[model samples]
Target: MRKTLLTIAATCMWLAGTTAFGQGKTCEEAAPWSNMAMVMDLASYADGGAWYKITPTANSMLPFSLTELPTSAVQVFKGCNGEKALVMSEEVASGNISYYIESGVEYMIKLDVSQATGSFVMAMATPLDLSNAPDGNYCVKPINASVGMYSSIKANRPTWFKVNIVYPGMYSVGSGFSVPAEGAAVTSVKVKSGDCGAVENSSNLLMPNQVYAKAGENFFCVTCSGDMKVLFQMVSPVASCPNHPERMTALSAGVEVTYPNAVYENYWRFIAPETATYQILDKAPQGTILQVGTLDENDDAKFFCNFENGLMAEVDESGEGKLLVDMQAGQTYVIASETFNMLAEGVPSVKISKDETGVRSVSGSSRDIKVSKVAENEYRVSSYLLAEGAGVYVYDMAGRAVSSLNVRPEGDAVTVKLAGVPAGTYMFLIVGRSKSASTKVLVD
Candidate 1:
């Protein structure tokens, strides 16, 4: 969906008052939840007659008090078998809500409270994992929000190997391989001539890569007489590797081996060079999920995604994260379930450099730009800069600003600090005494 700031604001308002939405398919549906992608909404309510945002713990239950229950809080429920359930007690005064989801199905609960009315109606601002629901039946009888579930990803094949030939010249054929996520490990790489004659067998030579695919086209040698196919295999004990973020199924392929003294960048663009499309992918920890609810005031609920807790992408209620990423025209992306909130909303782009000519040296004074997170509840902001006194902040998909540091001209070096931050994309800005220059940074 093409989200706008207004849309986010509206969603937040909805969450503040009530909670409704689940993350996966009903028993009538079948799929591995949302493939590790997610779509989220916000909500809020009053507590002890005082309004505050509610944060769910790893256990799938909400902390509540009779003194905090109000008519403005919206409550949602679902069946244990992934079936949609009705709101048992329509009154917001009810202190607790419930749901029932079946095994193998994922559900998302949303609570938007931007409106503080004492009543709420059943409405869906967004759908969680409805597209790929598993087959079954279930009901919602008031499930705890803190319950945790174990989930796994089905192994497939390698994605692709993107090899960029930096040096330009001649290329030859050697041995190579690729690996899929949590499958088998490559043991060796071997190349052969047209008649199965061994051309190269690699035992001492080692390729550090685990996975690779062709970006566009494959390469071949000009002197090769006929077509030659390279074969690869891997070995691994069943369940030898635990559920690891970096584990993968490994394979190998043949590449044009360059001479020891050759000066060339010519290389083959190998596509699907692995046994299959089972590449290493990050999965959410057991019991991690997103619910749609609002603050006590019926305002939007604000939350963040964290790798520390298995959240891949997070953004504030302003839809700023969607803006930071390059969006496509007509592609689907996961928001609150998995896949770092998959986003295929815009056309893919590559940053290119152009020749530049300007004053070689420029000098200016130093100034400290004070910055802090919006709240202790806010996600870590990854990068912060002063865009002409207008601070430009960057956060992870989890909505935490990863970097926030003061920047000012001091001699030739610009002052920058990257503390308490994780590796990800970031935006930076520096407002000079008059103009401002903004740039992107990759903290890898």
Candidate 2:
């Protein structure tokens, strides 16, 4: 069921004699001595207020205060994208306010002093320093850090950091993943070069990585709203990360290898010598997961199969993290651990194996459904074999949604019209009530 969030303006009306939309005694209307900008940092004080504006590129959660005690009632307001809303007005007022600021919007911070005296104290500090994180780099394993975004709403100050690597190898940050906001669809946790540096200068083999870890100084940070904490740990590297993973040596079929569990996350490059469907088998202790994905020429991993996270093809129910994948020979495949929120447990060794038989990349679920372009801006979807309804969703190479259509079978197939779309290559994902299938389409 879909629930709509009700946002009622929490405004207060304070008037001893006169009547107006705003309080009779406001910080802006009161004498200069009545309102003071005591501080501009949330890491220090809990009482004070300041004018805030949305950061240029990112969303901000500006923190502020109203009164020290719930002794009076006055209406407080917060703004978003230059629009203000009644934050809260209560008989007792003493608490913090978090303003969800939109980029490019200027907002005002005012106190209500009609029913009771207004307190002025605000705390918002920069880079909310992590202990011993000079130059914003943490050199040790299981490093924890916080990017204080809730207090830095008016400023686009992203918590930045670099790892002082004692050794050089591919690494991955584990556990304690930072969330931008509750219920947000997408968020990123990554490592880059020195503070906010370019991707190429990153010490890790993969820039902006989520699962793959690097053992080098690849700086790590998160871009999101609210205060967040992330955990970092070094990971084993696949020997190949020179931008082109395909050039790396490929693992032969039917080979089982014992890898150390010391590295929580491990990466391996597998090159399919021919078109085939393959299963990656992990015989490690229970709960050890296996992730596999195809990398482009630039070594960028696509939405491959992740059995551990249950985001892709289903693995065995025993929870050992076995995954099936299909790809052409010469394709670069990289596999990593999808561990979250915990350290690697006792696994004597990670046993890895694969069996393959050449086939197409279609799923057994959507085998009855087929999508193909019959003409420009027009495609044909046939689902005569399906026992249920289906829909087609278009997505870009990076997995961002382009559009979707609720397709009904006209006889044995349905025709979909997608006009005015620019020329490009996109992945077409077909969804049934219970199962789904995906295929790539080139638009001209």
Candidate 3:
């Protein structure tokens, strides 16, 4: 919306204490309202009234207010070219007013003062543009800690925003603002889903504003009293993770990794070369507490190791803790490290060490399992534990089961054919009634 300054003078004629038409007194002579305060000389105009034109650039809910209007009435007309129709009328001593407006439509506002004396201040709010904002439902970007949007809200008016959810998860939506006048505050924030006209599901979000949202669109309505400037913010747990390949680093066992600067959170991608148990140790400055967790294919929290749990030990005086877990070969995993305190400025450093206790066989069985690739998408498996009802399962690196087949032994070995399977590194597990053996295989 563009801003413009407009001022008009009216010359009135009075005969036998009766009012006459003058400039800015009729529909055709109405001055344009351009988001600025207009001063009126009530004694110079007939009936102590003035007319103004309002034309919006987009569909908006305009909030306007009249100050020091002790004895006044406001009327809104739909059309301007002499075919005027009264749409709304309000009688107020002094306060805010709101009306819905459509794009490219002409409207007129008539302010009448019954006292026929002094002047009053008129203010109108501009429609905010949220096209580039990440929190909007139609926006394609995601919001982080560094990005936040701001807008103003008027008293007794509702501000609407469409919240866009790209990834379904728990999120925090919060607002911060300053109250410049009495009764000026943000009252409530409501979230709704489904049809905007009909409420399918609606809920109010209070302080510590946390909400579980699905991947789609949601409507947010904010109501406030008085006029205030608000800062809107939205954050997700996965916002700190490296979303691209360039931001993520590889993790290998026995290598100590360190970041350049202190960060709230950091992530690393790890692929196991052999099936075994590994221990991760965090070494940082004293008084630093870190939360270690793992993410799944959907980037959701798969597992977390905390000080309260036995999987992770408490930080000692030297600020050292260990997390022990077992990993399978040919499987991928994401490790996430986050700090509880934002004030802590120590950089993150961690080292992963493989346990020398060796791989623990399934069901305590010591059966030897061997897998060898022979042809395209074909592998030969030889296992002593193969028996009736024994089956082989194939899983991709992400631990998603892709194929399963029942095996029929021919002599001592069986040939497994993966016809439609894509070329990738996969884990093959042979399971019987009492025992199971697994091996990693690469398909060309």
Candidate 4:
């Protein structure tokens, strides 16, 4: 699943393109600069040095400038708004964070830490001066399967974050390899296994909400007890998709969608100025229909019910015998259709009524109607009495039965006075000899 990515910083100067330089002679010599790139084995908890740091093939760190803030600083400004921020991480233990001299003004400058401990670089809106900023450095404190780090800035900006525990399970690191637990509710991911190589090239190219691991590393392994659980040390939310993944076609509108159908007087639907088209699609143990309709005209806005398949299902769309209808707003109309064994991709059709003022539809599918306000404070119950004799029940939203009524109504109609009911929303059910129908209604 793909999600929208948001820029979390405001300083544009930090993001400005900088010429790539080579790593300096040593930490003693280059301690004043930020480390551009490195890969570490976070799983090695035995020795803090077990995590190896690689010098950048070329220096990618943005040099601190005084003329104007770097575009990358924009991220710091946005992080203050309560969104997550990316900070810088160090691979070596003795590296020092050095500040450069600029103008006479002092500013707090640094990366913002994410919920995960990993450091990220982003642009910030505020221009921070390093010349007078406080002099404080931070480091990652490692513990077995537990992540911890400390950070501080000259001012109130959140400069540090850390994870308390890291996963310590064996996992398989390869393409198309997934390490999900059985029945575990999958909420988010930081990487896809197949795209490991791309992550190495550009750390920002990983997908959001994915599980990721370093390529060619022991991504997964088994415990001595033979129980297997995938262990991930830490994951960053920064996702980079170079290909610009495909767009998802959501179910905006389509036929055969699972929905309640209650049209006028139990017929399918009818039309006048509107158009509708219904076709029987699948019928194995049961028969299902797919209907597509549109508006015919802008003036006429009422739907009719044939009472068989449907009666005059008129809508605004132009065309004959179509399901789509355009009716004036705010009109009361009645639609009727049968309930099904289960709510599959198919449901009963919707019914609308025609009026000169506006159009209104029936109160959807109702197996039973829990009348909350039949007469002011008093309430009555009713439902679509399709079967000759059906058991009807009414309940509140809390699943408590409000009333019970047996019905042998005259042709799909039942009117029972609910005595002393409160004003609220209620649910109703109509149970046939074997099947049942249900719907909700509000009583003012």
The local distance difference test score of each candidate is: 0.25, 0.40, 0.50, 0.28
After aligning candidate 1 to the native by TM-score, how far in Å is the CA of 396 from where it should be?
A: 13
True-structure lDDT of candidate 1: 0.25
lDDT of 3: 0.50
lDDT per residue as tens, model 4, 272-310: 333332222221111112222221222444322221222
Cα lDDT, model 1, residue 121: 28
Most accurate candidate by TM-score: 2
| Residue-wise C-alpha lDDT for candidate 3, range 314-381, written one tens digit per residue | 23334555556687786655555432211224655878779775544322122457888787767887
TM-scores, in order shown? 0.20, 0.31, 0.26, 0.19
- Which candidate leads the pack in lDDT? 3
Model 4 segments more than 4 A misplaced: 1-378, 382-429, 434-442
| Per-residue lDDT of candidate 1, residues 300-356 (tens digit) | 442221223221222222212111122122311122221111122222111111113
State which candidate, 1 or 2, has the greater TM-score. 2
Off by over 4 Å in 2: 1-61, 64-103, 106-238, 244-267, 271-277, 281-423, 427-444
Per-residue CA lDDT of model 2 for 295-379, tens digit only, reads: 5442455233222222232212233555566667786677554221122344433333444454334233335457788987898
Clashes of 1: 157
